[model samples]
Structures are given as C-alpha cells and as structure tokens.
Target: MSADRETLEVYNARAGDYAQTMGRDPAAMASLRAFVARLPKGGRVLDLGCGPGSWARAMLEMGFEVEATDASDAMVAEASKVEGLAVRKAVFEDIDDVARFDGIWANFSLLHAPRAAMPDHLARLYRALKPGGVLHVGLKEGTGERRDRLGRFYTYYTVAELTGLLADLDMVTDDLREGADKGLDGEVAGWFTLTARKIVPDTEARTDTA
Candidate 1:
C-alpha cells in the first residue's frame, strides 16, 4: 500500500486510542505559546493535521482564532467534537489559502507525508500563510520513510535536513531544536521541532510566501 494510504488507514483505525493517549509536555506547550505570541493579537491560526484538537483548543484558550484540519476523517471528527473547535478533513497538498493564516501548526503531522511530496506540501503551506506568518512543525529523527509499531508511516529528517527543506521553500528559521523524548505512544524517540517565519519583500524586512 502507498505510505499515505497506509498511514491514514492506521490513523483511522487507531484515532480513538491515539487521542486518548496523546501527551503534552509542559515545556513544549510553553515553547508553542511563546512562538505564537509573536503573532498579532488574536491572530488567525490554522492547525494543520490537528489530531483531536489539543493544540487547537490551547490556541483558542490563548485568544487566537483557530481553524484546523486533518487528512484522517476519524481524527477530524474527534477534533470537531471538541468545544469551540471545528476542524475539517483535508490533505497536505490541498491547502490553497493565500495569505490566509497568521500561523500554521503541523505538529507531528507532516512527517506522515512521503519524502517526495514534502516540497510540494511545504510550498502549499508557505503560500497559505500571510506574510510574516509563523510556521511550527514537529517530526521524528531518522533518515527516511518507515512504519512505526502501530503501522503509521513516517518520514524523518535531521535538523540540517529540515533546515535545507524549509529554506528551499524560502522560510526564515526562528528556532529549531532536537531532543529525545517519549512520544504519545509512550515510546522514546528522537524528535525535531521548528518554528519559522514567512518573510515578505520590502515589508518589515521579512520574506514572502505568496
């Protein structure tokens, strides 16, 4: 089976347990909060591939207007059930908004996309963001594609690999960190986390995604 289909099938089959067991590290949350704090007050945010809407809920509580989506219908259903959150089902390449978001969060989601599809998705994500928009992403560390014990397909990247990929999309790096920690499945894995900004030409000295 294709990695995309395999991963989605796995997520659809395990959405309930996945949501139930999802974990939030205080430090990670703090880091996210600090990153989004840079946006304009009550900025609009898109939680890309938001599973179960945890970060969507957090962003809502923090005063941002949050829109969310995931490729998995089951995951989207779970996210939409949360109070004040209405996530839709959508795939990575389908994001077509132009300068529409102040921030985009792809926490542990984009890793499921195959390596070949990454640049295209990244380009779409870049174009979807408003100038100066913040982009946050999380992925595990490894060389390439593989399946976890749960049968979910994942594409890993080194910190340098991630940097090169984002720069190829013309994104400006704000922060990148690598660490080993327990994932939601209660298994320890090396992780890559990054916060980057879109800059527009001749505007506050920032780069443009449009």
Candidate 2:
C-alpha cells in the first residue's frame, strides 16, 4: 500500500500537469454539467479533491455556491487562482463538517483512497450532505490498487461493490452508468459513475432498491 505522505507527494509533483490536462477535457466538462443538473438551484456544493478548481468553476457558473478542496497545497493554490472559488487545502479524512452541503461532487478523487478507508470516507460524505442532498462519484471500474508510471496510487471498484458500500450507509443510488473514455494519459479506461441521494428523515424508514 502506498503511504499517504507518498501519495500526496506524487500529486503535488504532478499538480500542474494534472490541472493542465483537466482543463482540456471537453468530456469532463460535460460530465460535470450532467452532475450539476441533478442538483437544486443555488445550493451549496463541496467539490472534494477539486483539482485546479475546474469543476468548482463550472458549478459557480451554474449558480451554485461551491467550496473546492484538495490534499495537495499545489492543487489548492491552483484552484484558488480561479475567480469566484473558495479553495482550501484539506484531506478527505480531515473533513468533519456535518450536514452542510446540498451536493458533493467527488469526480475521480476517491479512487486514490485506500479500500479500507472507503467506508469511513463514505460516512463522512454522508454526514456532509443535507437531507436529500446529492452525491456524485466517478470511479475507475475494477478492483484492487495499482500505481501508474508517475507513481500515483489508484484504487478501482466494481459496481456491485460500490453500490453495496453506499447502500450500507443509507444513501440510495439514483443512477449508475458506464463512462469509458480516453483519459489524460492517453489510455482508455472504464469509469463507474453514480449519483446517490441522502435519505431524508421521513424517508429513512423506506427500503432502498439501488
């Protein structure tokens, strides 16, 4: 397993490259648009692991109040440079806010988290969202962990595994789709995209079919 310190170092080293690559992806922008369309108008959004603030910028353009955060200081600096974004440097494990967000966009960020930490991360995400708040996660579709040439660690998940994990948290998944496309590294990868909604107080008693 890659240590958190090493992971952060790898990302910090490549932060500028990652930001540049993300800026040129039209598909990523489209996906961000689709994710935001599911949210209510003028709601608060937390872009977890927001790199370079692109997604946060898009959300701001769509009339949502957004807070962008990442673990790497370099990334936070880049994100803060974007106009109209509130950027912070934070690790996912350090987030302890409760019921403050109307939506959480975690695009391709959780994949860096160790599998053992996924449950707790999901719980934190649950706690961060308001009742009926939306959570959109984009993950690579597979299992186990691997390191790319750049030495960044990545964890992949199967749909059933991811769905089961979320279901255990009382969050009902509203949609799941396969999103295979060429990524920044010029390699085709399969993506599992899910949109889950927090169960409201009155609806908590109902069973989730997702």
Could you say which candidate leads in TM-score? 1
> What are the per-residue Cα lDDT tens digits for candidate 1 across 87-117?
7788887789999999998888888888888
Worst 10 residues of 1 by lDDT: 201-210
lDDT of 2: 0.83
Summarize candidate 2's per-residue lDDT along 1-210 as a digit string, tens digits. 123676678767877888877756565666677778877899999999997887888789889999988988778888999898998888888779999999999988898888999999999999999988999988999888986565667899999999999999888885677778776556788887888888888656564433
Clashing pairs in 1: 199-206, 199-207, 199-208, 200-206, 200-207, 200-208
TM per candidate: 0.90, 0.89
- What C-alpha RMSD separates each model from the true structure? 3.4, 4.0
Residue 210 in candidate 2, Cα distance off native in Å = 29
lDDT of 2 at 173: 88
